[model samples]
Target: MKNPVPLPAYLALCLLLLSGCAAAAGSPGSAGPPSSASSSVASPPGGAHAAHHGTETGSPAPAPAGPSEAARMVCGDQPMDRLTAILELKEKPHTVSNWADSTFTCTYHLAEGTLRISVQQAPDEASARKYFDAMQALAKDAKPIEGLANLGFPAYETADGSAVFQKDSFVLHVDASALPAVAGPNAITRNALAYQLSTTILACWVEHH
Candidate 1:
């Protein structure tokens, strides 16, 4: 059976369609300025690329340059025990015996360029933790190192060359002379770089210990 449609409803729908056609015909083009108009409606605000323009009238906005290399990295894991052993380079082949041998990396971005640092080891956590502790002590007694005091990648876990944290702070600062295969803008940049690397180390320590 065919259902009868309400007259008002049908008429209103027809009027809306007719109105839209009339409006388009009478109105000037709504297209924006020619410079750029964000073509893709679905793209993110700062998307790297613009969307399809096949059916569109707008162009995509420019993508932001965004953060540099240094800005991309964040602080990560290395903790007390891991810090000590790695810094000290204790037990060479053996390491702290608390973690496994692996590769670690740190990167820094400066107006000059990006500094990438990589540290490779073949030892257990306990040994690496020991080395890390010794290095922390040296960094403490070592001169202010000029601009690096701001970083505050302090010495942790004292005795047994173990790094201790006054608070739960998990950071480490080092110089190129301090750790091989790590590159940074300057000592400060390196310190920041070290801090990032330390986080990774700390993660390894946590897994093993």
Candidate 2:
């Protein structure tokens, strides 16, 4: 009979074989350098998948389209609800009060100047006319505003029915001069100037009366 190895020696030999097999593969004591494949295997699921992702395969998320190329976007969101604009005046409380109803924008256009006044009225030519009337009164007495420099002003009414209150949209235009040292630069101001005039005139009236 062939000589048989001792039991302990056989067990040791099995352990050595297992250890060597581990080294060949990428187990704990493996000798070969780590490969990309082995690293992926070592990595956890989510991280590896995210790292090696390709471009979106199918049905990718859509992008938002930008603003439309139009001259102006009107009424994308305008309120249907109605509101009034008010100019708080002092001395001419009754005249100012006349404007206080259903306040809205009233525009006055003149060859030399213009007036934009906020007042109350229903939506129509008639209300707009009344609003203009109130603005005219305010303009005749509008004195020197605090900040505006070198200002010479007079409130004149336009025979042309350009300035009026409307049921819906109201626009008031006024020609406010800078009172140039040379009378050179004349400009038509916007809403704020008109507002300022209205405020100043009314406030002064309030202070006086």
Best by TM-score: 1
Question: How many residue pairs clash in model 2?
Answer: 18
User: Which candidate should be chosen as best, given lDDT against the real structure?
Assistant: 1
Question: For model 2, where is the 10-residue window of minimal lDDT?
Answer: 74-83
Q: For candidate 2, write residues 105-202 as lDDT tens digits.
A: 22323323333333222233333344444455444333322222111222232232112112211213222332111111222223233333332322
Work out how many backbone clashes candidate 1 has.
Answer: 43
Clashes of each: 43, 18
What is candidate 1's lDDT per residue for 106-155, written digit by digit as tens? 33322334333333221222323443444444543342222322223333
Off by over 4 Å in 2: 1-122, 141-171, 179-209
RMSD of every candidate to native, in Å, equals: 30.2, 41.8
Q: How high is the lDDT of residue 167 in model 1?
A: 12
